[model samples]
Target: MKKWKAVLTALLATGMLTGCLGNGGGSTLNSESSRIYVTEEGTFQTATVESYVQQDYYNGDELKTFLEEAVSQYNGANGQNQVTLDSCTLDNGTAKMMFHYASPDALIGFTTQYEDKENQVESIAVDKLSEVYGQSESEGVTFIKADGKKADQKAVSKRGESQTVVVTSANPVTIQTQGRILFVSDNVVIKDSHTVQTTKGKSYIIFK
Candidate 1:
């Protein structure tokens, strides 16, 4: 009713959505916490699983409705279904909301509209990683494997047609990709070969 972001802040402030934060992420089959799934084509889906507590003054159903309406409004104004709320459900005080975006740009626009400026996916590029990030690849641009091992410098130098994702986020969430992650930024936590979690500030992932 009062726009989605404001309402969510109010709900959290009122303790209607109260619970411990999550450390892991989820996939299409199971979403343990909140995670973003990215494909080779750059389209992605997000599973937002947050804890909540039932209270007489706060209605979970109403919150779901508000979320749906917010997504719908954003899509409608964009003149296409660039963003869609795949599902929203509350069970045992845990709320899971799934959103599918046509592209990374769609997600950027949606987040911008909600005033969530801290989380930004600025660019998904196929150019040289150093050029995209405006740094010298020769200047010890540290790139580590998903296992936190130093990636093969030879392999990095020989990169060809690789997809690079440049993201800046203060929130903690795991990002999953279908391709083998060649390297990730310093602030990223190694989740697995195919996934990495953001710690803070700027982070990048290069995948085949």
Candidate 2:
């Protein structure tokens, strides 16, 4: 009886330790706290990336105009198009823009040209409506798929030396990292779901 009791106590202690370690593994990227606005005028939605820094990276009005112009151009060229800017906001430490398209093909067309345009500001944009899952790596960015495939992806250029990670996907994703800057171009639904933290240079999540 004495030996059995000792074994049970040891097992319980091990379980507790495992639970604590599991909880400390990764951080969540929640999109609920971001400032999101939706409107029928052009069927547009806008959201700002919630960040530790309060300073605005891009002029909101200017970005709105840019997106509006892009939509006009796309509509003029395509006769059967329904793609529109879903949201544009500054989150994390970078600028991010998202667009909604009627189909995957439409998204492809817009990404080809809009992504190549020369601009004074550095920002990330999604060609189609997507849900991005990302985690910061010490060397660069790492993306993981729902089926456990490591995705090969790169970040959009930044104005400064700081590195940025951009991940776009149609399905929800899981991220594992210590902490890094990320700018998402789609609606983000944090896997585990946690509060957004705003400490300069600390780990946090921002959805655009």
Candidate 3:
């Protein structure tokens, strides 16, 4: 799979409800008005790497505009061709909306390829492994107790620093798994949450 898609896919798969971005991995957004407008708080870390895809570039306005408008339109009238907004909350000074949009064909193709694999990625589930991070489950991946660990699959984080906990084991089983949890705090607030990864025939369970 392409790099961008992989990152985006991971982000989508994790099912993070909501979060905005700042200079660091943990950034905050603040809003004073009852309703906050469109703003891509964090860097387009995942989407930027994907080919033929730009973070916020449309005919004129940025992709943020399109996303906000799309979300507003969808909220006004629930119908087809509308992306789903999983969560909406205020963080710092920004009003963030965690949402899911139709992934491009290239991404879909990559997903299909991985899905076709015998034990590639059938399903993923999350359990509250700790106060911060969560436990992830999949075919090859096994659940192990970890305090709070973050690894980077991409260069998103030079050290692969993440707020989520995911483990991969090299036992007889061969599977890929990822786990994530979205929360809000004074330091790092998770405005919303959504799925990180899910295939057509796959399912992910989350333990509160």
Candidate 4:
């Protein structure tokens, strides 16, 4: 099986659900879209779900084997254990799978192997917002607090230097990081204290 379709076939085959992207991860078992969990170390895991009517020829066991094999091959080629198939299951016309990667790039590399663009999610983690999104944009962008007030520049700057800023773009992804979220860009919608969602353009998550 092609590495690109590994994430797709596992989810879209059954038309189930999907996962997430960011320097974040979570234990959420079910999500309408992809939910990604990232650590301070940059390691991350994604839980994807897809659901569709089950066809008579669909064999859950065979699909699982094929997915595991693909994961093995990818890990072997990309460095042992760089990517792992944490789980894959198909039940009652729903498919759910989780993948663990050494880094967000590893996950991106695996999902976006196809050139034509399927399951293409790009994510990067930087120590500061200026590191990736640039100093000009970082300084100019206004982030909001959980209370819905604009984040002050002094506080944002104080934590900006030590914060982990995760910038990612995907098909409606939910991103969670281990650090406390301090601010987010206009494109980012705060889902919780540590989780956010972005649909258009690049989304930024600045956390301390």
Highest TM-score against the true fold, candidate: 4
Regarding lDDT, does 1 or 2 come out ahead?
1
Model 4: per-residue lDDT, tens digit, 163-187?
Answer: 5555556465667666767787666
Per-residue lDDT tens digits for candidate 2, residues 88-152, read 55445444555555543454456445532211012222221123222234434333322234434
| Colliding pairs, model 2 | 49-90, 49-91
RMSD list, candidates in order = 4.3, 22.2, 15.3, 5.0
> Worst 10-residue stretch by lDDT in candidate 4?
18-27
Model 1 RMSD to the real structure? 4.3
Query: Positional deviation of 155 in candidate 1, in angstroms?
Result: 1.2
Name the TM-score of candidate 1: 0.73
Question: Which model is ahead, 2 or 4, in terms of TM-score?
Answer: 4
Q: How well is each residue in 1-208 modelled by candidate 3, as lDDT tens digits?
A: 2443354345445533223222211122211111111112111111211112233311222334544564566545544433444444322333333333332222223323322121122222222334222212223222211222332323221221333322121211111112223221111222223122222332322211
Off by over 4 Å in 2: 1-57, 91-93, 116-208
- What's the TM-score of every candidate structure? 0.73, 0.32, 0.23, 0.73
Error of 3 at 176 (Å): 14
Q: Show where candidate 1 strays beyond 4 Å.
A: 1-9, 12-30, 56-64, 115-140, 170-173
| lDDT for 34 (candidate 3) | 15
lDDT of each: 0.64, 0.35, 0.27, 0.63
